[model samples]
Target: MKEGTVLIIGRPNVGKSTFLNNLIGQKVAITSPKPQTTRFPIRAVYKDQRGNIIFVDTPGVFGKAEDLLSRQINKKTLESIQEDIDLVLYMVDHTRRRDFEEAKVLGIVRKIEKPKILVINKIDKTTPSYLAQYKFLEKEFDRVHMISALKGKHIKPLIDDIFKFLPEKKGESEVDFHEKPTPILNIDSKTYVAELIREKLFLLTRDEVPYTVNVEVEEITPRSENLTYVKAKIITTADRYKKMLIGKGGKMIKEIGRLARKELELMSNKKFYLDLEVITDPHWQERIE
Candidate 1:
């Protein structure tokens, strides 16, 4: 059976997270319209009759990582690339122009000696096409595929190609599907819940508030068979940002909690009482390790 690791790399807002989520047929990463929504590399397993594959979804590489958070995120992505990976999927958004940021990511991709595939995403958007600009990469890579990750278009063929390049496993599989509790590796239940809250903050907040904020799930208790109680906090850089998140009479925070709770219930098929609060932490970004 074919089995190996495939790493997905791209620039910010190119739909790398979306592609990973769709490819796994589940949400192991959080996504947003905002760039750098994915803070770190997420490892998830994908299994089928052919083989078991480990997929690493990495944070987008920034052209200029000015802030502490952006620099850390960029560092994490570059570090993931240095690991032992069997194949690489260099994903790009054809609707966007190929500029210096694209060049920055491309430069990294060019250094990799392993098998690579150029995946041009967002083919569903026809007008305002920058398709011609990325056409030159076709000759550079042996395989290229145009897909719309959001619409699940042409994904099957992409999977077929990915399997073709994977190395065959000679003995018993390292991962036993029946014994594995979850496909996602590298994160616990609390971290997953925290990410859900963070995603809501990204969707509901404006400007720099989303980037400045981080979520922490402190306590998760099962009060009953059908209900789970969760306590969480949102850490921000300043009081003004905290106020903005709280909004007038706490309208904004309430909306964020309501939306997050709805999604939690939908995914877990149980009730969740999320105790969410926002606080000011001037050095929150610096604390990231």
Candidate 2:
């Protein structure tokens, strides 16, 4: 058996989280179409007969950030590319035009001495010529795999190839694929619960609202063997945004809570009593600093 750590790096909204969820065949990470949807580094374990792949899904690598939150996110993303990693899965949205940020990321990746593979994601939304745009990437990496993380295109082959980068074991024989292997992750319920709420907020709210707000889990109390109570706060920068989130007659917040609770219940496999509140704090992100 072989084991390795693979860091998934890319600019925001490139389906990095989506790829992680698809690879593990579970929703270990929350995802949204909005840029900067991922704010922290999430780790998940994918195991098979070949070995195990511990994946680190990072925030999108972007150029300078004005806010303290964005700065911290960018720093975390770059810090993930460490010597301890066995392979780097550098993903890019094939449909978008390459920009200065992409060039900056490419330059940093070029200096890394670890083995890496260029994964061109979102191929389902592009034409064959999309490959031409990223042709330069082929020369920089040992191999390239074009895939659609959302549509689950060519995911199995991508996973198979990822195992090739892991350290090999002697006297290891291939195991039966029919015997399902259980995937594992070291994520806590509180963090993932907050992420689930944040994902719904992003999908429900409009421009600037999603980025300005942050979800914080206050408590997760087990009411019974089969039931749990979760209390969380949605922190925002201003009162107006809070009003918008709450909506007239508290309809908007109710919808957000309803959707988030449903997902959390399914994820926890327990009845969840989700208590959500929106608070206005202009320096919510900075206060953590």
Name the best candidate (by lDDT).
1
**Model 1 per-residue lDDT tens digits across residues 1-289:** 8898999999988888898888887788999999899998998888788887788889999888898999999999999999989899999999899999999999999999999999999999997789988988888786999999999999989889999999998587766767766574678989999999999999999888898999999999999999999999999999999999999999999999999999999988999999999999999899887
How accurate locally is residue 266 in candidate 2, as Cα lDDT from 0 to 100?
76
TM-score per candidate: 0.97, 0.91
Worst 10 residues of 2 by lDDT: 172-181
Which stretches of candidate 1 lie above 4 Å from their native place? 170-172
Q: Per-residue lDDT for 4-77 in model 2, tens only? A: 78889888888999998987888888899888888878877787777878899999887667778889888888
CA lDDT, every prediction? Answer: 0.91, 0.84
Residue 173 accuracy (lDDT) in model 2: 28
- Prediction 1 global C-alpha lDDT: 0.91
